[model samples]
Target: MELTLVDLSVARGGVPVLAGVSLSLAPGQALVLRGPNGSGKTTLLRTIAGLQPALSGQVTGAEDRIAYAGHADGLKAMLSVRENLTFWAAVFGMRDVEQAMQAFALLPLADRLAGTLSAGQKRRLGLARLLVTGRPIWVLDEPTVSLDADAVALFAGAVRAHLAAGGMALIATHIDLGLDAAVLDVTPYRVALNGVGFGSSDEAFL
Candidate 1:
């Protein structure tokens, strides 16, 4: 799959967060969106994922073409890991939740309540949900949060394998996800009150 962002900007409460950000991505590639807190990383990710509306510019990618993992795991607090995956699989119309559970190494925690799992475990479970969806583009927001080195490596390995399988990703991370992906910065594209948008700057978001 290929995605093109043409002069995209996002605003919250009428204050511009991201301004005139444009980029192109294709399968087997990854673009890291790196920035400090409140620098529009999350906003950009949300816009790309269609969770948030774009203030200006155009987002023409297929709506279901991308799967998003936000800062929150978005797991059902009352459900067990297995039940959560099962629910998501059914929601996404997957035929096999067990396959996805095993893929993410959640077999052991299948019976554990999602709310009771550690942060790392929860993040892994969240990532597992993405696998079950089978979408080609992954929009991850701080996917490594609360993960230990080993889990981080596991996440990175999963990402590498995805890219190898012709998948693409857009990651917004404060910590290194170790994906060897290219970086893009939204700082240079911040919308000024009087500017036309994406005004000819090439600041790196990574």
Candidate 2:
């Protein structure tokens, strides 16, 4: 499978953030987006995940095959660790959460409420859902925010296995992901901050 963007333009709050961006990724491949803060990395990832739309241009190969994990853990505080994964798995038409638990070292805390887990644990639980979602393309935004070093390694291993199994990942992160992937600097795609949106015909260029 492949995900490709052609001259994509994206916006937030009805204002353009990224413009004329293009990239492609194949199975068993990853693209690590790196840029200074406010460079539109998150907007780009959200567009690819279908959570948001591109203002202009096209995104192909990412129709119904995306599993997006954003900065928030997205867990129900009252739900147990196992229940959390199970719920998402079922929502995605998957039936197993065992592998997800084991993948993120969450089995020990399976019955623990999500609200009680430490930040690192909660982050792992969030990541574990990716496996159960059973989607081929993973769109991750700042996936390692609160993880410890070992947890980060585990996350990297899981991503490696997914890619090895012909999955694709598009990650927006500032920290190292400990993977071999292409790095895209989004600075150039950032829309000018001169009070003009992609809707404007005459605007400043950076």
**Top lDDT model:** 2
Q: lDDT for each of the candidates? A: 0.80, 0.88
Query: Model 2, poorest ten-residue lDDT window?
Result: 197-206
Local error of candidate 2 at residue 30 (angstroms): 0.5
Clashing pairs in 1: 184-205, 185-204, 185-205
lDDT of 2 by residue, 1-206 (tens): 68999999998777888899999999999999988766777778888889877899999999889999987899999999999999999999999899989989999999999999999999999999999988999999889989988998999999999999999999887778779899999888887868654433222111
Clashing pairs in 2: none
- TM-score of candidate 1 to 2 decimals: 0.88
The weakest ten consecutive residues by lDDT in model 1 span 197-206
